[model samples]
Every structure is written in structure tokens, then in C-alpha cells.
Target chain A: MNFQPYRSPSTGRPVRAVLFDTFGTVVDWRTGVAREVAAFAAAHGHTLDADAFADHWRALYQPAMDAIRSGQRGFTKLDTLHRENLDAALRHHGINPDQFSRETLEELNKSWHRLPPWPDSVEGLAAIRRHYIVGPLSNGNTSLLLDMARDAGLPWDVIIGSDMTGTYKPLPQAYLRTAEFLDLEPGEVMLAAAHNSDLQAAREAGLATAFVARPTEHGPGQAVDLAPEGDWNLVASSIPGLADRLGA
Target chain B: MNFQPYRSPSTGRPVRAVLFDTFGTVVDWRTGVAREVAAFAAAHGHTLDADAFADHWRALYQPAMDAIRSGQRGFTKLDTLHRENLDAALRHHGINPDQFSRETLEELNKSWHRLPPWPDSVEGLAAIRRHYIVGPLSNGNTSLLLDMARDAGLPWDVIIGSDMTGTYKPLPQAYLRTAEFLDLEPGEVMLAAAHNSDLQAAREAGLATAFVARPTEHGPGQAVDLAPEGDWNLVASSIPGLADRLGA
Candidate 1:
């Protein structure tokens, strides 16, 4: 299992808590959406390209945030961003918006609130909890993440979402604000996720980082983000593997 | 198991969450401190009155904060407040500050980080969480409540401490600020606590209120607060009782 003791780069504090990124990291968004969308469309008398729709909606996610962040557009939630893409996908599929009321579209946007957790997530987190404080350091917003935790039975000691800080991750302040809220120095925290970019940002902000591989996150045609790209504090194939190294 | 529903005075929206006063409501602070002080006095070789000391400390508590709220003192955390009280208590007990190193004194103050939860707190909160968002909404800051939750296994779905609003309860602004943070209307939330005073303030601020009786909280000679004094939405003998009436 390669159970080697790792150290934080900036501070000598043994890592106390591990904060996880939710979507595509602890929760499988792609597969969860594909399955949910297929069923949702089937209930309405049609079969949709669930995977393609998922990819299309996710593709619009970053640019939509970019517009909001850059002040090119008014601030809108991820739910609104997802609905815009949903409308576009329906139009592209030759379906009228009249087919579904604004209320149904709003409810469908809540699919983000019900993503399936990664198979190793729940038990592996339970394992990790024996040693450290384990919770989400997600950008998913507070209410959405809270509903997800309740529905998925994710036992978290605390929930730290961007809504609490009014900023998104990869931004240094977002990571630092999270540590401040926990009354711990940034170096005492470890950001754990399957994304290399998030790890790079955390490392730059003086927090230890752990990388877990989830290659299928970007979908079957995904070419990039195959593995860890930086000298992360720890790397593991799955959540349980990470727990094993941490001696949980 | 009669689950009679009480409509909100303002909105009639079902209570989706119950915010708490934290310290004396969910935790048995008197018993918690009495044990800590007894252990400290025994270890250091002196007969100290931990129970009397707890009373003195809590007595000084609101006055210190009232000083801050009234602009007599600057912003200070509960940890700092406890430290000052510990210093005063040591002087009263004839313990030389120089006898203990600064590190030892600091550790003594940190005893608050490990408070004992009330007997029904954990299981009752777990049952209530099955139906609503349950968490601490105390004058204690977020870090303090979060640490207490970890130490005591308080099953909270979210945390809304005074640190977020930069104010304390008894002020209508404190209750209003919590509703603002949750994106919930005031009447959609309920303030549940063992203290009728807390429930009264919340009710005045337009939130639904539930009073859970904690008769033994103040220990022997605790005659004042054994029952609800006002007309609360739901009054129960304990947290589990409250959960049952709320349909958990």
C-alpha cells in the first residue's frame, strides 16, 4: 500500500483535517447526470443523449462563471447556469421551452443537488474521520452542498463552500478563508481531490495537497488530466487508499 | 407520538431548520466545567470550587460581551474571554501565575474546546436531523462551535455562529442575520433552545420557536428556568421529544 509518512511543505504541523472538493472528485457528476437525465427524459416520452447533454452543460460551466467573475454578466448561481445550458440543449434537440414550464426547468436544474457519490467515498470518508476532520471544501454553494450531503449520507464534520467566502477555489483567498474559518493556519489544512489544478492552487497557498485519480471524470473521450502533474504531498488511486496512507 | 403541526405566525412556511443557542442549550456547561476544574485542582494540588468558579465565569460572560457590544471593549473571542476568567479565578484561588508556565495556563483555558454534550444531545440531534437542518446559532464563533461539534459528536447539517454576522443574539439583528445567511425567510426557520429567553428573542424576531426544557442545567438551587415561560410553538421535555413533535 506504500504507507509512507508525508510532511507539509510550509508548516511542521501533522495534517489535522482533509478538505475535499465535491463534484468530479468525491461525487461522480458525469455518470450521475447521465443516468438521471436519461430517466428524466424517458419519463417525458423521449430518450435524450444524456452523456452528450451532460458534457454540453459542463462545458458551459466554466465560461459562464468566467462571465460572472469578469463582470461581463450579472452574478448568477450554478443552478441558473445549468438551466441556461439545459434550455440550449433542448432547443438544439428541437424541443420547445413551452414543453417544460420554468418551474420544471428549475427542478431539473436541481439535478446538481442529487449527484451520486463515488463508490469509495462514504466508507472511505468514515475511515478518514477516525483520524482527521473530514468535510467538503467545495465550490458548489452552501444549500446545494447541504442538500447533497443529506441525500447522499455524507457524514461531514463541517461544510465549507464558496458561498461562505463569496469566492471560488484556485483563488488563493478562497483556500485561506476556509482555514481561517476553521481557526487553523492554512498549512495545517490539506486539500484532497482528484484534480491536479486544485492541488497546484492549494500547494501555492501553503496547504498540503493529496491527489486521487479519477480519469473518467471528463468523460470517455477525455485526453488530458490523466494523472497528477505536480509534486503533491500524497497521491492515491482511491479514497480508501488515501485513508490507508494516513493510517486511518 | 402526536405530531400536531403549528403554523408559523408570520409565513406559515414549514420550519426547515432549527438554530440553537449552543453553550447551555446543547451542552451541559456547568457539569462540563465542574469536571475540568476538579481535574485541574486535583492535578495541581489545591481544593478549588469548580462549580462556584463556573458560576462566576458565566456571570462575568455577558457583562464582558455587553461591554464589547456597548463599545467598552473591542472584539474578543470566547477563548480570550475564558482566558481572562481563568486568570481571575486563579487569583481568587491563590494560585501564583508564575508557578505555571504560560503554556500550562493556555492549556487550561483550552479546556473549553472539550465540553461535555448533554445526555440527549447526540441521539436527539440525530433524530431531528432526519427532518431538518440542525446546527448551533450561538454567540460563540464558528470555530468554537465547530470544535465542540467534533469533540461532542453533534450532528449538524450547517453551522451559523455569531462570527458570520459579527453580532450576538438577544439583538433582533442576530436572528435576522441568520435567516439572511440561510436564504430562508424568518418564519421558515425556528430557534430551538433550552432557554426560554432565547426562544422569546427569536419569536420576537419573527422566527418560529421551540423550547426544550433542561431543568438540571444550572445544577442544585437552579430554580428559575425549569420550564417554558412564554407561548412557544412547541415545548418538549428534551431534544428527542421536540423531534417527535416535529415529525422526525
Candidate 2:
């Protein structure tokens, strides 16, 4: 890939750090989660629509965070939130949570930790890391991100979890506080995400933004974030392409 | 080197994460800062005792952090603290801060970020990383640690900065909060340091401890932390030796 150095238009400075939104951006979470669900159902001697099951579980993600973002509840790590949603997801599938041992349920909950990265994630991140600090600015807890990085071979220079920021994405603190943690001006940091909404929030929070399209993130019926909704600083179809554009 | 797997005597669990004290432990801060001081002095046509200057600056480290630890001051990042101490050190050496430009002073203050790692730091860390997560749990702030890791080729899986914990080392939170961030029990995390006082505090906080001696850290006349003072879980002469004892 040809290299083109990236500079933030907002500050006219070369980017120093590039953070990523992990789920559905760097990793194919839907497919990975569905694969786990299929194995889980087969082991339990039950039939489940794995794809729909994965979607159903993910659907609860926002509402759970919405409660925290709205200050209706205190901040909580995504792992705990995912566990609670897992029970709800089970009941929605007409299965009782009590049927599974605590150990089994806990293992199933860890599907997020074993997610497979997109084909280009590891190589692209390794490339970008040669020139810039690379890490995940994800809603995942520190352990979840660490496990995924170890399992998926994501060559992250660092890991920034929502637990570290005490908040989730779309909140200004999540982006701004992360920049502070790195001792960087917001403009020196770029957030590359597949979701247009995440990019929009990041831009508003003073970070440079890059939109990486993941049209199949929702398994072909994806209706949102298909293209950059705002004038993102950079736009690319894949993580490798983003790295190329960044001259890494 | 013979390999021996380490298990915490307190919990009998295999260590999952190994964090180290960066200054004077993983890196020779005194030599590094002195090297930069000599260069800066030569550039400015001034003669200074570089080694004594380094020791004088370092002598102020604990007193600065103690003020914050005692709640006499709010938590501050090490960069700012280091910059403040640099001015004091300059005045103590009969040099005025006004003799240098703001940029020059700022660059000199970053000498800590460019410290040279010990011969065993990179290889030992990479070996240990194959089996466990590795990082620096130093009083250095996030940016300082990130800069040093990049410059020294330190393969950190994560960075737990003093700023991240809102406190400095020897404080219980510095040790406990780091374990909490990695979702590991204190017993599952080990702190490797050249200082027995640091290991002693970590042990009191329920963490496993390893003493890696840097007997010349304070120049050949170093008298403190020459040997393990407490019954640390593991003791080695160097980081690679520490890795051998961990069976990595």
C-alpha cells in the first residue's frame, strides 16, 4: 500500500496517536459471537438462531449504557453489563438462565474476549504502530480488551478501557479524558471507527476522526454507518487502507 | 538460564501479570539523565557535574510525591513534577533557569522519557510476555511511560500510570488499583523492582513480589536496596534472571 501521512485538519498537526473502536470496527463481533452461540447451543442440545441471537444480545448494549450515560445509574464495566444482558437474552430466547451452570454461563459471557479481528486488523495496526501509538478506545473493560488483544494478536501499544475513563463512548469524557491520559491535545489524536455516530461524537469532542466502512457489520442488512455521514478527516474501506492513508 | 515457574505463596496461583518499577529498576535513570545533562552542558558551553546533578534532581523525587500522598497537594503528573524539580535542581547547581529557553528546558525535562533500558529489559520482557502480560507500574505518568516504552522498545501489554491511579507508588491504591484494572487478584499480579521498600509495600497489599537487584543504581556507592530486605517471593540479579525464575 502507498503511504500518505495523516494530519488533523482541525489542528494542522501530524497525528501522534490513533485509537480504535474495537467491536464491529477492528473485529467481526457479530460473526464471532454467532459462532460461539452455535457451539453453545449444540453443546446444550438446543437449537438457536445464532445470528439473530448475536444481534439480540448486541441490541441490549446501548440501552444498558444509556442508563449510565444519562446518570440514572453509576458507571459499570461492560463485562458486568454484558453478563446482565446475557441473562435477559437467554430469557428472550425462551431459555432459563438457571439451566446453565454458573461456570458455563461465565464462559459463554467471555465470547467477547475471544473475538476474531478483521483480516487486516493485526497487520494494519502493526503498520500504524510503527509511526504512531496504537490502542483500543473501546467500551470493553481492561480485561476484555487485554484478552482480545492477546487472543487476536492485536499489536496494541496500549489499551484504554471504558473502565479507565469511568464512562462510555459518545460521552465527551470518554474521548477527552483518553486524550488527557496520553498527554495529547485532542487534535493530535485520531479516532478511527466504523460507526459514523462514533466519529461524529469524537469530532465534537475535539478529536480528529476517520471513518472505516464496515458495511457487513450487521450481516448484510446493515442500514446505518454505511458511509461517512460527516466530513471525517479521513475515510477508508478497511483498516489496512486507513494505515496506508496514514503513511504507516 | 534454568526455568522455574513462580506461584504466589499467599494464594498459590500462577502469576498472570508482571509489572515493574521503571526508574532505576528497568532503566538506568541516573546514567541516562547524566548523559543528557552532559550533552546539554556541552551544547551550552557550560561545565557541570552531570552525575551529581542527576542525584540531586532524584533526591527531590520522594519529597515531591510525599506532599501529594499526604494530601497536602492534589495529584499531579510526574512530567509537571519533574519540570518543577528541574528548576530547583538548576538553582541548586548555581545555574539560573533564565539561562535556557523554554523549549530547551522542556526538552531537558523529558530526559526521563528517553532513559536507556537495562540490557535485559527488552529480551526478558518479550520472553515473559509469551506467558504473561507485562508492563511498567511506575510513578511516571502515562505519556512518560509510553514515550519510554517506544524509545526503549519495551513491549508493554498495558500501562498503569500513577496518573491513572490518581496516586503514587508505596500507596496501597497504586498496587491494588493496578490489579483491579487487569481484573486480576492482587496475588495473581507480581511487582518486580530493584527497591525492597517498593516490594515490601506491594507484599503488604497482598501482591506477589520479585526483587531484581540494580546495585549500581545510585552509582557504585549505592548502599540501599543492595539485596532483598523482605521475604520476597522471587529474587534475581537481573530482569532476564527474573524471567527465568518465572519460567518464561
Candidate 3:
């Protein structure tokens, strides 16, 4: 595939770092979560539509974060949010919350930390890291990101997440604070995400933006975010494609 | 040389993460700084005792941090502190600040970010990382630690430093906050350092501690911290020695 390097028309400063959106961009969370949930359900002699359970649990992610982002609740780690959402999802699915031991439930909640990286994530990140600082700028808390990195062998130069900034994606504070913490101008950091909305927010925060399509991020027949929504600085189909375009 | 693992007498919990003290424990900052300063002076046709200059600059480190730790000043990144100390050192050494351009001075101040790790730092960290998450919990800021890790090829699974906590070491907050952020009990995390004072503070904070003696951390003929002053959970002569004792 032919790849074209991106240049910021506004500042033209070279990109020094690539801050990624973690979930669908780097890891196949939907598949990973569904697999773990199915295994857990089988072990506990419970019948569950694991795929639906995974989707339902993820559907609660944004609302949980919205509570903190909208100031309705104080900042809480994504791990806490996941546990609460997991319990609610279990209850909603007609599974008695008491059916699983506390330790089993806690282990299941950490499914996020056990996610495997997308096929191209590790190699592409290694390529990018040779030329630029690369890390996740995601809603996952510091521990979550760190655990995922270690589990998946993701070579992140740094880890930046909403937990550090106490705000969720699309919030100006998240993008701005990430760049500030890295001691880089927003223009010097590019947000490479599978979600157009995340790139849009990053662009508004003065960061360079790239869109990498994850056509089946929500599994087969997934709709939305399959194409770039705006005139992103770079658009690619995979992380390696992004790496090539970035000359990494 | 023979090595023995030291077990914690207090909690006896297995270690999950090893937080390092970066400057003296991981990197030879004194030799690195002196070498860079000497090179810069020769390039600028200046004559100076680089060894004494490095020592004098380091001598100001504790007092500068003390100001912030004592609440006399707001939290400041170590980069800022290093730059301020660099200017003071330059002036004190009878060099006109104008002799070098702003960029030159700025580059020189970043010598800290380019310090060479001790011979065992890379290998030892890699070994420890196999069994436990290993990262620096130091006074250095995030960017500084990131740069040094990249330059020195340190395979840190995570990076946690005073920048994240807005406090310096020997303070309970630094150790406590790091554990809180990692979502681990203090007893589950070990603070590995070359200074007994740091290990003492970690112990008091209810965290496990390991003392790795950097006998020449302050350069040859240095006094104090040459031996373990307290019954730290583990004590070793080098990072690799520490790793061996920890069974990593």
C-alpha cells in the first residue's frame, strides 16, 4: 500500500509522539472480553450469551465515564467503573450477583487487562517507537494500561490515560493534559485512533490526528467509524499502515 | 559472589512491583554529567574542573527539592529544578552565562535525560520484569524518565515518578501514591534504592524495601550509604545482585 506522511498545515512541526486510543485501536477488546466471559460462564455452569454480555458491558463504559466527566461523580479509576458495570451487566442478564464468588468476579472484571493486542499493534508500535514516543491516551486507568502493556508485550514509551487527567475522551483536558505532561506542544503529538470522534476532539485540542479504520471493531457487520469522518492528517487501514505513513 | 533473597518480616507478601530510585541507583548521573559538561566546555574554549562542577551541581539537588517538599514552593518538575541549578552552578563557577547560547544551555541542562545506566541496570531490570513489574519511582519527571529509558534501553514495564505525585522521595506521599496508583497494597510493592534513607521511608510507609548499595553513587571516596543502615527486606551490591536475590 502506498503511504503518505502527514504534515500539519498549521505548524508544520514534526510529530514527536503518537498518542493512541487504546480499545479498538490497539487491542481487540470485544473478542477478548467475549472469550473470557464465555469461559467464565462455562466454568460456573451458567448459561450466557457471551457476545451480548460483552457488548452490553461495553455499552455501559461511556455512561460510567460520563458521570465523572460531567462532574456528577468524582474521578474514579476505570477498574472501579468496570467492576460496577460488570455487576450491573450481570444483574441485567438475570444472573444472580451472588452466583460468583468475589474473587471470581474480580478476576472477570480484569478481562480488560488481559486483552490481546491486534495483529499489527505490537510490530507497528515497535516501528513507531523507533522514531517517536508512543503510548495510549485512553480512558483506561494507569494500572489498567500498565497491566495490558505487560500482558500483551506492548512496547509503550509512556502511558497516558484519563485516570491521570481525571477526564474522559473528547474532553479538552484529556488531550491537552497528555501533551502537557509529555512536555510537547499539542501539535507535536498526533492522536491515532480508530474512532473519528476521538480524533475530532484531539484536533480541536490542537493535536495532529490520524484515523485507522477498524471495520469490525464491534465484530462482523459493525457499522459506524469504518471510514474517516473528517479530513484527518492521515488515514490508514491498520496500525502498520499508520506506521508507514508516519515514516516510523 | 553468593546472594541470598531477603524476605520481608512485616507483611511477607509476595512482590508484585519493584519501584526504583533512578538517579543514583539506576544511572551514574555524576559521571554522565561531568563528562557532558567537560565536552561542552572544551567545545566552547572554556576551562573548568568538570568533576567539581558536577558534584557542586548535585550538592544543590536536595536543598532545591527540600524547598518544594517543605511547601515553601509549589511542586516543580525536576527539569526546571535542574535548569535553575545549572544556571547557579555556571555562575558560581565564574562562567558568564552569555558565553553560551540559550539553546546550548538548554541542551546542557538535559544532560540528566541522557545519563548512562549502570552496566547492570538494563539486564537486571529485564530480569526483574519477568516476575514483577519494574519501574522508576524517582524525583525525575515523566518526560525525563521516558527519555532516559529510551536512551539507556531500560525495559521498564511502567514509569512512575514524583511528577505524578507532585512530591519528592523520603515523603510518604510519593511511596503511598505510587502504590495507590498501581492498585497494589504497599506491602505488595518494594521500593528498591541505593539509599537506606529511601528504604527507611518506604518501610515506614508500610511498603516493602530493598537496598542496593551504589557504593560510589556520589563518586569515589564518598561517605555514607555504603552499607545498609537498616534491616531492609533485601540488600545487594548491584542491580543484578538485587535481581538475583529477588529470584528474578
Which residue window of length 10 is worst by lDDT in model 2 chain B? B1-10
Per-model tally of clashing residue pairs: 0, 0, 0
DockQ computed for model 3 against the true two-chain complex using alpha carbons: 0.74
Q: Can you give the DockQ of every candidate in the order shown?
A: 0.64, 0.84, 0.74
Model 2 Cα lDDT, one tens digit per residue, A1-248: 44345788786877899999999999999999999999999999988999999999999999999999999999999999999999999999998999999999999999999999999889889988988999998999999999999999999988878999999999999999999999888989999999988998999998999999999999988898899999999999988899888888
Alpha-carbon shift of residue B176 in model 3 (angstroms): 0.6
Q: Which candidate is the best by DockQ?
A: 2
- Tell me, by lDDT, which candidate is best: 2
Residue-level lDDT tens digits of model 3 in B1-248: 34333346776777788989999999999999999999998998889999899999998899999999999999999999999999899999998887778899999999999999998999999988888889998999999999999999999887876778879988999999889888888998999999888889999999898999888878889898989999888888888888888887
For model 2, the stretches where C-alpha displacement exceeds 4 angstroms are: A1-5, B1-5
TM-score per model over all chains: 0.90, 0.97, 0.96
Where model 1 places Cα greater than 4 Å from the true spot, the runs are A1-6, A40-47, A67-99, B1-10, B67-76, B92-99
Which of the predicted structures, 1 or 2, would earn the higher TM-score when compared with the native? 2
Least accurate 10 contiguous residues by lDDT in model 2 chain A: A1-10
* Candidate 3 lDDT by residue in tens digits, A1-248: 34333467754877889989999999999999999999988988889899899999999999998988899999988999999999999998889878778999999999999998999999999988888899999999999999999989999988875677778888899999888788899999999999999998899999999999998889998989999999999999988899898887
Q: Candidate 3, after superposition: displacement of residue B177 in Å? A: 0.5
- Across B1-248, the per-residue lDDT of candidate 2 in tens digits comes to 34444788876887899999999899999999999999998998888999999999999999999999999999998999999999999999888989799999999999999999988889989988888889898999999999999999999999988988899989999999999999999999999999999998899998999999999999999989999999999999988898889888
